[model samples]
Target chain A: MQLQINNKTHEVDADGDTPLLWVIRDNLGMTGTKYGCGLAQCGACSVLVDGEIVRSCVTPLDSVIGRSVTTIEAIETDPVGKAVVAAWVNHQVPQCGYCQSGQVMAATALLKQTPNPTEDDIAAAMVNLCRCGTYNFIKTAVNEVAGRKEASL
Target chain B: MKKFLLTLIAIIVIAGGGLFWFVTHKPGSPFDGETASAAPADLVHRGEMVARQADCVACHSTPDSKPFSGGLEMGTPLGSIFATNISPDKQTGIGNYTLADFDRAVRHGVTPDGKRLYPAMPYPSYVKMTDDDIRALYAFMMNGVQPQNVPNKPSGIEWPMNMRWPLALWNAVFVPSGTYAAKPQQDEQWNRGAYLVQAAGHCGACHTPRSVTMNEKALDEGGTDFLAGALLDGWYAPSLRQDHNTGLARWSEDDIFAFLKNGRNKHAVVFGSMAEAYNNSTQFMTDDDLKAISHYLKSLPGDPARDGQPWAYVAATSATGNAGKPGAQTYAAKCGFCHGTDGRGKNEWIPPLAGAASSLISHSESQVNVTLNGSARVVTADIPDAYRMPSFREQLSDRQIADVISYVRSSWGNHGGPVTPEDVKALREHTDPASSNPIVLQMR
Candidate 1:
């Protein structure tokens, strides 16, 4: 099967039902996406598929056959992703750095979808879990990227 | 007056003797007079296939036990009864028994010593099995299977309730003794399918409702209640009939075939007890047999009155409109990713909650049980399914489960009705081994 990952088409040998995270990390050798709760509960394996954030651990390889998958490796290429990365660095939002990539992908997808997202919108969209309690920092950074008044909460 | 009293006593004696004979009598078997002999290799091979169709091992063997060395405990109203060892061991199993003994036990629910086997053995359904199949099954039991020296466990029922003679009367009233007669009106495929479902598959053992006496209401499609859906073992097996909402009205013959063959279809995936059937029996059936089963099941008509309004998907007007409702937020956070916000699961991989039989049926046991305890893995063709419903018992409260299930059952044109926290509580306590006292339904 051919997969469009980070704008590069690659032929991969795998079952269609194989999780996209497995194909992305093992088959494509892009390990930026982290595996947390494989049941899609913890969204640590978040990746942008055709501009929509999908939990790659639950997303089957066949579901994204022709779609573009943007991992943390290619996040800075997009304007929105670039801005989100800058805000993350400015905020120094990394305790373990394992979940930061997925967090960055999630924030980029949110800001891209809702450029002027309010507190409610941010709360709804930024549902990815960060065990290091990096949520307040993530919210502040996402608020900065959205060009909104810095979120006090 | 003394002469009249004597006559009355005589009459009473005769009637009592007749009643005793009727209850204790074993039905005659064609193999009765024959001696035990080794069966041909081909007959034994065919017998193995017959056993697969019957799914004999599902109850007869536990995970750790040797195959056919039955020790699985089944809960009944009287008490728990253990499935007897069917392997041909000389002492512990049925090795010493002749072919006639096997036939009587399998088809007539009678032991050689005049004990009546419980209906849990499903001999009512097995009675429809052809004589040839019985011979083959007997042959396999004697020759193909390894003789395991596993002793049969006694029933936990106490003395008076454990008496077997009454069940002979129950069998007489409820069980029909005959092989499946081909309906000349229907095609060969339908007849073959009917034979499998009614006889070997014994689908009605779960799908058909039981009477107060614990007899299945209907043994075949001749009765409307046959496969009309029944709740058992904490799961509601949905109707095989063609009802639009709670049955297979929307599923095509091909869809049914795919479901049986592949363990999944676009409309639903095999879960609950059906997963065990699929894993052990249905998936192993030949393509032609599956097609025949599909053709026959499709012929059973659904009742409009019983099924109520047919379900069709009603698109949610707005996400915000449903946000205020109980369990909405829980669904979005916990379920929406895999099941989708629309409740249409990811295309054949994850089954759609919208218009699903679990959601459409008024009996919400399947819905609640699956939600609270989660589903068993659906393994198809040796490959475990990519997705599975995770257990939420520890994560969510009984109220949360009820609220979320209520939200699902009521949403997306599903009319499964509201499930109360008590409903969730009962099943939770029942399924949880730590709770100790599970509510066991006393089958009258």
Candidate 2:
């Protein structure tokens, strides 16, 4: 299979039925996309498919061949990714640092889709399960991302 | 040629002398790995508190795992590493540790013979512990704990990477110590609880989140989310803060004290990390300390908005009967045999299901998971007879499991939430029922 991962094309060896998670982790050596639940019940395997946050655990590799695959690795490359990471670190969004990559991807996509998200917007975006239950921080940081002028500017 | 020879001889002599001096000056430093700190009373007392604050017993003293002899295989992305014996046994434990040696191991994350302890040991969190606490912990281990001859099994952490020294860098950025200082603005009980929860107990070790560096983001007061809640291992340690959904939003000060003291109260029941806390740490605490913890917890005002619609049990359609639902039927089949028709569990033995804290807490996850997986049999000293809630994995399907849990939650005065089969299935995949022969070991 071929994928435009992080804006770079790469040929990979793996079954198509396998979730994009294994391809990123075992095959691509990008350990950033964690495997909290292979079923996507926990959004720990969330990544960007065409700038929209999708649970990579449930997403098949073959389905998104021509589409772009953006992960935590390339998150810093995108403009929205910068804002999300900055907000995450500044407000300290993560607790166990396990569910956060997905949280960030979701929040980034949310902000990209809607620059100013309210509490409800954040709640909807943060459906990912954080065992540490950093939901409060998640709400606070995304709120900061929305209020900050940099998000739009 | 003559000058070059003379310089070489001078360099060699100085280098040899420097090595000799360096080795002698740094007492019990990394260079000298053979030192031992004998068990002293002071060391023992301190170690007791340090261990309590760290909740070391929670994981180490499992049903089969010897107390501090460390056979409980804690799970991680890096595979399982059984907790090690810190008992003073010369053959099987750290009876060979010196003060500085223990200090390095405790606060610095270095082991007695100069190796790094994995973050799983919570050295990253302990790195914030003060020197005094470290010394006291050393004293406690050296003196307080009985010696055990059980050898520590090697951790499953694979080759070359298992080397401990690299953890030094992980520590440098993340760990910073200086015992908790109370907020002058907050009253005494709150301060006391904060101190106990953060420092003496190091509750945040499990309760707080970590940064990318794997260090606890904020140790105490500076972070609003401190002691709020975080997930560790398989269980979710609910927020110590007064949040509505999964925290003590509606719990009173007295309720907190009761839960900590006896393990069950009207608002919540002790399960998961909390049960261990009750079995080992909180249950052993003095009344004043419990009150103080309660008082502190009470000071945290819950976000009424998020805590949302306070739970009120709707009267059963018949007022005195189980609703004719799959949940009710499943409850009768597997659970009602022990829990009673009313959902109130037996005292000290089978924890009551109705109106208990876990069921009352808005988030139905813990309630559903515990019912499906059953509880880890509590084992304390002198009480060899322990009771375990058996796993329903094979006997019940996800829908059946969800119905049974939902029946318990909604039946009596408890109002947790209506659980879905999806929730049960998710937990079923993630969790394995606790062992009847839990990893308990004995220190000599």
For lDDT, the strongest prediction is 1
The digit string of per-residue lDDT tens for model 2 on B1-444 reads 999999999999999777545433322433244455455665676567557656667666556555677677776677678888777788888877677777666655666555567767665455556666766776676676777688888878786767555565565567664445668998887887766766556677777767766677667656766666565655667667677555776578887887777666555456665666666777666677788888876665555564445555444656556756657755643565345556654443445676554665555667667766766545444342233566678778888888878777777767677888998888889887766543323322
lDDT of 1 by residue, A111-139 (tens): 89889999888887778888899899899
Q: Candidate 1, B383: how far from true, in Å?
A: 2.1
* Model 2: docking quality category: incorrect
Candidate 1 CAPRI-style tier: medium
Fraction of native contacts under 8 Å reproduced by each candidate: 0.39, 0.00
Over 4 Å off, model 2:
A1-153, B1-50, B90-92, B112-114, B128-131, B159-166, B186-189, B209-217, B304-306, B318-324, B336-365, B377-388, B406-426, B429-432, B435-444
Q: Write the per-residue lDDT of candidate 2 for residues A34-97, one digit (tens) a residue.
A: 9985534567888988997776765657656899999998898998899889988887777789
In candidate 1, the residue pairs with backbone N, CA or C atoms under 3 Å apart (3 or more residues apart, or in different chains) clash, namely none
lDDT of 1 by residue, B226-254 (tens): 99999998999999999898888899999
Give the winner by DockQ: 1
DockQ of 2: 0.01
lDDT of candidate 2 vs native?
Answer: 0.68
TM-score of 2: 0.59
